[model samples]
Target: MTGNGGGAGPARLGWLDALRGVAALVVVFDHSSATLLADFRRELMPEFNTSRFGIMVFFLVSGYIVPASLERRGCVRTFWIGRVFRVYPLWAVVVATVLGLGLCGVVEIRDFGGQSAVTVAVAHVTMLQELLGTPSLLLVLWTLSYEMAFYLLVVALFTVRLHRRSATIAVTLAVLAAASVAAGAALPASALSDRVGTGPLILVGASVMVVAICCASATSPVLRLFGGVLGALPALVLVPFNGTVPLWEGLVILAVMFLGTAVHRAEHGQGTWWRAAGTAVVVVGCAVGSAYRYGDGELFTRRGWIAAFLAAVLTFGAGLAWRRRQLPLPLTGLGTISYSVYLVHPVLLAVIDGTVGRARRDDPALEAAFFAVLLPLCVLTHRWVEVPGQAWGRRLASGPRRKPVGGPERPLLPFRRPCERTRRWYP
Candidate 1:
């Protein structure tokens, strides 16, 4: 997250860090449990769905901060640059490490379902592989696809001057999510990819994303508008039609994120709290209704999904409520390295799975040991990889920056380089 002003003071942001830290640990447990705490997971997941809880929290946090980051910058080019540097460096390092591990025979790489290397590489490079019908190389990367989609949508709104309508957008997505289920509009995963060949879809999607980003970053107003609209095309086409997740779920994900944005807007006085509260109500109700009507998925129960969703929303609300209080350093520190924890843990678990194999039974000691090892390693990754990349991004973004036409009010969007002032707040 960038910028320290716009009503997001240290107290407000610290709670977000605490939330990230909590979510990271939950997600780490959700993934690692299959190998280290199999029985416990089996017992817990059917009722709680720890994975869903963790990610929903993440999406909410992303919603809360991402739009703020863009609006605070007031420059789409610099915003994109900041996002690329913040996300890609750690991602590239982790992907390369995973591939290296696979090549070394330390872990088995997941099958790409017969996709070509070129196609896979292109898909992953765009960070929309999950929505493009290509499997994510790492299990955790699917969420990044949605994050990228939100970024595009945010840019689109900023360019078109609809950036402040987050509450309306959020409610619309939620209602659509509910309505889709009511209409019984069931679509297979990757339906678009199935109809249009994977290669063709990837080619078109990747090409459009490149053009969209480049044009959105351009100085010409017409080009920016065109690029903004074009950028949203891929996300609009892919999320509902091609994502690996169910249609309702994908829509819900986006809605949840926008709901977070609404919360941020309310906090900053850009919008009213009543509007934010109402959006949250609509979104949560629609999400819960959609899950209920859709019934259970292959891997999760309806009850479990609903429980996790509610828990995530409640967790975020709790953090928001306590936004002013000073949070514990250990929790905030974990939040600082939460991204590293999220990416790095999957690789470590994969190695353990391929090498020694999973624990035959519930092993609390082994689970404890895994965390003991993971935290320190994530800290190192954060220090070496994340910090330097963000520093470079700031340096680059500082050059040749100008505010977008009709962007947020300057007083409401003050500039404060986050990397220099506060600890990193990974979405």
Candidate 2:
């Protein structure tokens, strides 16, 4: 959650960490059970949709923290730099490892459906392959597309001095989601690719992303503003027409994120609690309404969707209610390493599926074994890879060294200075 260089004390959000840990474990269970306990998965998925439940929690947390991260630093360039270091290092490693394993015939890679290697590569690098008519190398990477879009939109609002209007933005997007359903606007997935073609779109998107990040990070106000808009517009445009999910769901995702921001505002005394509460109601109503009207898809059941959505909201609310209380050490520790848990589990699962194949029957013991192996690996990766990468990012974003007048330069810490009461959370 690094957004620019700043002094931030260690995060005090034990409840949030606990919530994240819960969500990460649930997501792991959802995926692992599908492979190791298919009969149980078939029974549960039709009722609960655990994957959706886990991800919605993640989205809400991201919404609550990401904007605050950017505003606290008050520097777009450093924010982008921090994000790059925070996300890309491990992403690069994971992708390379997966690719090497595929090459070594330890696992199979996903086919790109006739797209050129260069186009697919560029799209994945931009982290928008999901929206750009390219398949995700890893299924979970699809969520990162929306996360990246949220980042662009958040920066756009911040640069324009409209970041404080979270409630309005949330309400507006929710209304639009409902309206899209009502109007029967049925756009096919990857509509942008259908028009511009996948190869060209990937090339253009990659170039624009490069320019946008560079310009937004520049010192010049004009460049920064231009870059911000350039970055946000694609997400704004594509979500309606090119997203894999329905247009309404895409809008709901944005709305849900802004709702989280509104809650953050209310908690911080920058906005009234009533306003946040009202916005939440409107967003929830609109999301459920949209789903009802759109009907269920092959992968999504309306009952499951509604249940998961409400459950996620309730879980987040519960966390907020108990935000000040101490949480279990194990829960907080899992939260500390949740990102590694999220990213690494899929790779391990893939390897498991490749080597041993999925269990034909329900195997709770096998599921437990998977967690036993995955948790320790996540701890190691978080300690050695994520921590060091974030530390390096802090040093780079801290800018040019200013020699002390009399004393030696102090050593840099891996953590940022705490912004008042603000704490870091990840997507």
Candidate 3:
């Protein structure tokens, strides 16, 4: 049943990947509306499917999976290495590429390209360009910073606990969230964020709430259902006039995730019907607001059904077969380099649209054609430069490894806590 390397792991959760992949594309699609479906997407669908929110879905998946990996891998180092590999190297390449282009004068030198060696080194190496207000060479790196912070938090917590304190340690973070609001701190909202989305304390609180909820979820179904409700409720907050929400809303996002993860854990029997429900919630809930804002206000009066259809299919449209471990190569490829793909695609849009789009202004057909070509090229970049860089990062962080039980000896993909074992962590 297993291959030489245990056939690249077991029935790989194609659904998670496929779902994540869809989430990414939906965000893209929603953004594309900025061009093609301009009015509809920016207004009606903005809340329905967003890149930031899609990323949160992956975080939910990660929150669920990381614990399992930790259980099998047996140490924090492996987890750290895996996370580093997954993030930095590819990022460095983008930073370098932007710099390389700046040197060549092929691209315009935005403020991010400064004249000093220290400036370049610190910005690129520390991944602090976003904080410096450099208009990130890669627009998506902001989220990477938050993700890195999340990783460091995980490592720090693990180190302090030494697997000794209860998982309950995550509880104290909630008070921090409340305090962030009180202190008026700037914490990045999601893993991919700018302006520190919320505040560190608030972020910590969200993480803690997430951890607490997940710990409870493993053994409780009711909490899971409650999570579903929490996740669904956020659709309401995405209003037509929500010009600015309090920083505290980020905590709400995390709170929804807490509920979402819980619900996902306790739920099963995935297929068409369930997918439809989720899609409806996201599409109707989010897209309606988007279309109402950006669209010509003809959504219900004109393209109402089309907006609804796209939202449903895009949001909750699940293909259970995609969840199988033996994922299709495209999906697998995307999953493998998703981080890179996410980072590169935004820049790719700016570049491709700048080049191809300038020539085809007032021609939506041309923009679509260029987008089609760009998507594959985008994926290839992920496969080559970014993927390899991430691999290098992991190798640096990694100490070496042991095999996952019943699996061939292979590099662990970081932590995913398991349910069966309580004290098997150090072994």
Candidate 2 ranges beyond 4 A from true positions = 1-8, 296-300, 401-427
Provide the TM-score for each candidate, comma-separated: 0.92, 0.91, 0.56
lDDT of each: 0.87, 0.82, 0.42
Question: Tens-digit lDDT track for model 2 on 76-141?
Answer: 766777787888777788899899999998888998999988888899999888989898998888
lDDT of candidate 1 at residue 203, scale 0 to 100: 99
User: For residues 1-427, what per-residue lDDT tens digits would candidate 3 score against the true structure?
Assistant: 0000001253455555555565566556545546555555546642344554565555544543443344344544455455545556566666677677667655554553333554535444444333333345555565443333334333433433332111222222223334444555543322322333323323333444344334323324344334323322212221101112223333323332332323333343222434434423442333333334333444544354334334433432344334444657666445554555465656555564444443322446754774576568767777786657556754554434444566443443333232222212322
Q: Model 3 residue 364 lDDT? A: 64
Which runs in model 1 stand beyond 4 Å of their true positions? 1-9, 296-300, 400-427
Worst 10 residues of 1 by lDDT: 418-427
- Candidate 1, residue 240: lDDT: 98
